[model samples]
Target: MKILDKYILKTFVITFTSVFVILFFIFILQTVWLFISELAGKDLDFILVIKFLMFAMPRIIPLVLPLSVLLASIMSFGDFAENYEFAAMKSAGISLQRTMKFLTFFILILSLGAFIFANNVIPYAEFKFINFRKDIAQMKPAMAIAEGQFSDVGSYNIKVDKKSGENGNFLTGITIHKKSNNFDGSKNVIKAKNGELISNEKSNILKLVLNDGYYYEDIIPKKYEERNKIPFAKSSFKKYIIYIDLSKLNNTNNEDYTISNTNSMLNISELKYTIDSLENNRKKDIISFVDNSYQRTVTQGSLSSNKALNDSIITTKIKNPDLLSNFIPKEQSEILQIANNSIINTNYTIDSTEQELESKTKVINSHWIALYDKFVIAFACILMFFIGAPLGAIIRKGGLGLPIVFAVLIFIIYHFVNTFGKKIAQEDGLTPFLGCWMATFILTPIACLLTYRATNDIGFINMDVVLLPFQKLFKKIFPSQNQ
Candidate 1:
């Protein structure tokens, strides 16, 4: 590298590193703010909390890296412009693009790094973060029950008035509500004087033992049956035990329950696989629905129990009303009944087919959208560098004051567009490719324009100069109007 290139590149690196560190801390604090409520009152271990913070960093890195590129570019170029370095370079025949050569290469390498991180580190981190949360959910037997609140453990809701014992295993004044099963619409309510929690590790069961409790089950009367009195059961017991399956709650050994195919947890290759599979399924389902509907309509509408009736109907374009009117009264009634049956069956089939198609379409859109988002971080970082450097030079200012403000404003626009486009894509409103790259498409031209203006030493915003002519034209058109 030349001496000038080395100097400029070194300055850019120093500013970039500083800005990245500051942004990392800010994002970490934001993470803490978001999840503090869940982590605060749990009396969790310090080491686990640190691990939680570690797993969360990968998710934040994707968001913060783009912003860092933007802010760093703004500061570096803005500082150079403010110090008259560009003028000196212009005198030496070094164009603005020439000055940015080394930094552009550096940003390209960073984009590659961002892609690797998104593919490898992000998927693993997402898996770990979500798995750790599930483990924490089943960490302790007492963790299931909170003081003065109902804890939903499977289908049972257990509420406790107060907790005692060294590990919060003993409770007083407990109420248990067991929700109705599919066979019955009656809920069973239990009021207990005291309770104790016992964990059976061998069987992987959590036994909730209640003492001095009364169970009440209310039965609803059937409309077709006459009852003299309300059918209910009241039972009093000295002790009762409710068994909860710890295997389901822990979910460590079960891949079916623990692992997910959600878009957030898939890498680029997995996303592509999912998209292909979903699209294939959607096509097959559509074909099947069409075949089923056609078969049902033709087969059900035939009265001769043969293909001859269907062939005649299709060949002659025979109307069912006309055919029924020519028959005697009884035969006409039978023909109308057959036609009505066929119409009802066709309507049901169509409704179900529409619902199935809608569901598959949503799944296909999800996979496509996820496939598109895999490139977002890498592309965003590279794009932001192009945008920020030229904008910084145009503004001719540096440091946290104007640089940060401009960075934030541009970042907000980028973020809003991305989020809005993604939301629309999720609902299958636009093609996945277009929805994912909408922000890039909107901002690329502006970046090119800014770069051109900065190279020519033109103002970023000269709206008044252009608007002055229009104002004069309007005045000529209506001289006495508002003014």
Candidate 2:
């Protein structure tokens, strides 16, 4: 290898490594802030906290690696240009493309490595991180009552408006859902104006003392016909005490804990399988719903009866426009009541089916987005390198000053577009493939333009290209006498 190639590779690698570490640390701090509630005041051991962060750190690589490439490329190349090293290389017959040969190959390897990490490492990390969080939440029964949001602890989902006092045992505006065998929904709901958590470390139970509370229990009817009545029991109490068993929760094994089914936890093959299964299930559901709706709304017997009635009416040549007038009052009323009930039931079914289908579709879209995201990470690294390397040469400014400004502005646009696309795709406004690649598609031309300008030794903006046509038009319109 030539001395020049060695020097260039060494400089770029050093800058890339430094930038990667700094950006990774910054993003890890952000991750800690995001999950602080799961850690803070939970009395978790230092080793557990470190494990939590370690499991979460892999997810940050996709975000950090590309940005590092962009900033590092710009800084390293811009420093060369600013120091007139590029001019010396050019005088010695080294072209910009020639200088980029080794670096391009390096970037290709980096991109491949990124793809491998995203496909394998990120999925594993996500699985561990999410399950670890679940285990941590139930590590202590008291940790389950996180303020402002629902926290699943054992069979009860607990939430509190505020928590105060040492150890945050004093709770305000508490709500709890006791999920028993009823997978249909939460059957028992407890709401309180205030509550207190009383626990003994030696015992396997936690005592919840409630003040000014209401208990609501929904009644399930044994008779199928009476199910629609929506019966329930509600009672208010000045003070209520409930015991929550902490034996299973305090056990850290989590053997009975249900694993989370988020898209982030699945690799490419798993995602494909899941997405296919979900789609097939959705199809089967739609077909079943349609058949059920048809049977409920219009049966074969009803259709035959309606046809007979229509034929009879046509043959009788009834002059009256009001069909109900022919029936007795009792029959008419009965028929109207039955019709109203069928309409109400059909409407309900339609609404519920629509919501279920929409939810399933969104879930499928999320899986597709996750699938495309792995490849996007690989492409983003290459895209950013091309943009940053050429941009540096064109601008000819080094250090953290101008390079930082350009990098931030460009990266902000990329991040914003990427986020917007994913949001739209999640809502089914756009296809997942397009949504995932939109930012790359939008910024690719900028990279090409920068590369071309830098290769030809043109400045940042080519004035000749911008003004040539305008100059010609001006001369033609003015009709210069000299011409």
Candidate 3:
């Protein structure tokens, strides 16, 4: 029995390792295709491209590991089934469930290791991947002006509506935004009908010549000038020259990347902390908004000749257009003044609500999704192992041919369901727990069904059972006519 267990384990281990390498390389090709445009023709260093791929590799592991387990298990067990190895084992008094014990233990360990990698390695890789992508985008400042997309270049962000000329240099309908300084928080915008970029790599400067453009720069208001509108200067230039410094573009040589507390960059524990903080702050904002709205609508009563007052009355109640019949001339002016203030306050409330809701979704739901996602993929590894092993026995078709087809089909379904759940979760349509685990709930039952069928040695569909009743009904309906 010990010798047999070792023999079974040897094939499983070898198949698993080979499948992992094949699947990892296959998924890397997908990553390359996705960002090929970002890397191609940008004159980037080979080392930068390699670093980008290296950082991106970890993100794909979580996606591939489960699929590899499925494929390898299916292929290995399919071979065992085809060779009637299970029959020989059963003849020797070994049950199918007993045969799975060692493999099951191995799979559990792999699942835990996957969890560790997801928690520790992926977060670091994701952070580096994002920053490396940014650095690559900066390699050619001109290419950064991608049509219909905002591209950040140094301290300025540029977008061009139409791009023409060789290497996409000539631009039309251009908008440029310089980063706002922290001190005053004013925006500087440049809108141009067209522009052309000329790079001076030797001096680390980019010259953008704009034709028929207007420059708009916001002037920060003094503390006392808060009530006044923020003053801005706008002027038109037939031809303007804007100098952009590129000295800081990838200046670190890919060393020190600033790790943001953004959802994608943070691990599970960091994610939980950020989620709690955002929820607490969001609650405070809701309370503050409600208080401000109440203060605006209800105020202390002032003595009136035609007293129709409570300690506090909503401004709307007193001066509502529908309540014109109750109007008193002396209170009319005051009511009108209060009515205008109430209108402004209502709009303010609406804007505040929208802004806070967006912030909460961005800061809270995103982190929650990331947190749940870590566990989902880790658990999927174990789940896929069960699914694949049994499916292999039932199919009884070994080698890459049939196993590849089944593995890819199942993975596509899994990946699609997982992506759908995450999308709805991000939209707040479902709770984080439900949305993140949605696929697991749906797939677990299928896995169980397959396992039961394989253990009982039932055929994939039990076609004869399904067709017998239909055949009998057909015979009854037509009586076969002795044909």
| 1 against 2, candidate with superior lDDT | 2
lDDT of 2 by residue, 1-483 (tens): 799999999999999999999999999999999999888866677888998999999999988998999999999999999999999999999999999999999999999999999999999888878778867865655576777888876677888988888777888999999888856553999999998888887776888899998999988887878878888999999999888887755645544445766899788999999999999999999999989987877652233334545354345554568967766576456557667777787889899999999999999999999999999999999999999999999889989999999998999999999999999998999999999999999999999999998999987987889999998888888887528
What's the TM for model 1?
0.87
TM-score of each: 0.87, 0.75, 0.74
TM-score of 3: 0.74
Count of clashing residue pairs in every prediction: 0, 0, 0
Residue 15, model 2, lDDT: 94
* lDDT tens readout by residue for model 1, 1-483: 999999999998999999999999999999989987557645567877888888789988877999999999999999999999988999999999999999999999999999989888887788877776666546678777777877777778989998889888898999999977657566789999999999865667888999999999887778636444658889999999998887767654354555565777788888888888888888998898889878877667665444554454456644466665544576556557878888887888789888878788777877777667768889999899999999999999988899999999999999899888887887778877888899999999988899898888887988989899999899999989947
Off by over 4 Å in 2: 140-243, 246-257, 300-345, 467-483
Per-model lDDT: 0.83, 0.87, 0.81
Considering every candidate listed, which one attains the maximal lDDT? 2
TM-score of candidate 2 to 2 decimals: 0.75
Candidate 3 ranges with C-alpha deviation above 4 Å: 137-248, 254-256, 300-324, 329-344, 474-483
For candidate 3, write residues 1-483 as lDDT tens digits.
488878878889999999999889988999999998787745466787788899999999878899988999999999998999988888898877777788888888998888888888998888878877766766665556677767777778888888777667788999999897676577889999998988754666878899998999887666755626878999999999888876666443546665454677788778888888889898898888889767755552233333553223335354555664455654566666666766786888789798867768765777888898889888998889888989998898899999889999998988888889888878888887788898888889888988899888786799999899998888889996738
lDDT of 2 at 270: 95
Among these predictions, the greatest TM-score belongs to 1
Arranged by lDDT with the best first, the candidates are 2, 1, 3
- Kindly report which residue pairs in candidate 1 clash with one another: none
